[model samples]
Target: NTVPIYEGYAIPHAIQRIPLAGKDITEYLRGLLKERGYNFTTPAEIEIVRDIKERLCYVVHQNFDAVLKESVENTSIEKTYDLPDQRSIVVGNERFRCPEILFQPKHAGLEIEGVHKYAYDSIMKCDVDIRKDLFSNIILAGGTTLFEGIGERMWYEIHQLASSNNKIKVLAPPERKYSVWLGGSILAALSTF
Candidate 1:
């Protein structure tokens, strides 16, 4: 909401990168399709499933388990996508469940933690005096952040980790898919980066 007076990461140790990303979500969606009796056996078929993830998968704002149950009882969250073969797949809880791995990698059989934890830990690694500032200025950029509701989910999860008195804000820009490129472009334009 306020103008940026300064933008820099003073504590390198506070920087973090989660092992998960968009490709993982795509693959997980493919697996979910298989579980639902749609066998995507070829690499080309995998691309179709990737398209399904792009169009259908989304992060849930509520508890993953709760939304899954609600989806079953509500049916509105479900989507049906047409395949190249003239057939179609009914995307149900898999819509949210596939992206759930970003928050709960165990679903993908990975012991790693969620993306929010990386941000929380990064803030905690910094000087206590600036932790609040970091939380209020969190930036979510990359192809993975393109999932609908993903930014909101990150805010919710990070808020759960901080004190109630603290505020959490996440910025997901419109061109976040090229965030790195944009940042580099800005730096390149600068005489001294």
Candidate 2:
């Protein structure tokens, strides 16, 4: 295990990537729409599916099954979005389900494990002295992290997996998708660089 450095410090013994990514979530959304008989199979049609995700996807914290159950009994939980062709799609559980793959991969039909556990295991492999600091400063970056409530869900899941004694915090900047580049640019411009 080898942890990558962030802001100039190495995080030893913690460098494995969770295979899931933003594209995976896009594909998951595409598949969901297709399954609902939306016929978003063509390359062009898939773009519409991506738009749906950007506009509506958000993670749900805990009680995923219960929320799904409630969705079936309550039609109001769903939202409708207008397509370019003047048609519309009724988005239901797919909103939360799309992002849910990052949290509960298997429960969302993904073959891989959950990201929260991946994070927990990686942190556990680090030196005990900095584990608490690491846990309390978890940052979620990248386009996929743009999803609403993802940070909260991440904290919830990681907190559930981590020992109760340590405090956990997950932070996602407002411009998460660009924050990495922005940080790198700042670093490159610094005298230390």
Candidate 3:
């Protein structure tokens, strides 16, 4: 969920939560593995899937349809990931398709709005005077946001949703995965009380 902070306080505006998250992408990739004739019902297997997703999955900004079609043909876009058993699995479309859920949740059977819509909606719910500030200070902090191209894709999508005159700036720090913890530590260090 995207929270708008104003005047050093988080404003209780649009607090939207969706079923779409990092786990959803992992689950989607797991399903793909199953379709490829790989049986994985054990927790250990699930961990392997999660590891593969974290290590290899990435977002694609363009040619999504081409990637999907080419993936089926086992094109050059495919990557081989060696499992602990010395067997390797070919990964292709799953790389971008899984992350595509962030932009189009319906692709993963989720009925909720995409991240771009959520962010725009949240800013719209805020006062018009602060909408620009909200757009300028957009901070993306989460494990899911760490995927390569996620920040770029988000900026492109949100920019499309926002007015042309409104400057949209999304901040995705390198250490975004631990942003909440780091933020708390900073607050604690700066607190006089």
Between candidates 1 and 2, the one scoring higher on lDDT is: 1
Per-candidate local distance difference test: 0.82, 0.81, 0.83
Candidate 1 lDDT? 0.82
List the pairs of residues colliding in candidate 1. none
Q: Which candidate should be chosen as best, given lDDT against the real structure?
A: 3
lDDT of 2 by residue, 10-116 (tens): 76558767888887888988878778877777778788888889888888878888998897788875889998879888998888889888877775577877878
Cα lDDT tens digits, model 3, 168-189, are 9988899999999998898899
lDDT of 1 at 101: 93
Model 2 reaches what TM-score against the true structure? 0.91
Count the clashes in each prediction. Answer: 0, 1, 0
Would you list the clashing residue pairs of candidate 3? none
Give the C-alpha lDDT of model 3.
Answer: 0.83
lDDT of 1 by residue, 112-190 (tens): 9888887888788777887778888887777778899998999999899999978899998999889879987997999
Give me candidate 1's TM-score against the actual structure. 0.91
**Model 1 ranges with Cα > 4 A deviation:** 1-6
Error of 2 at 94 (Å): 0.8
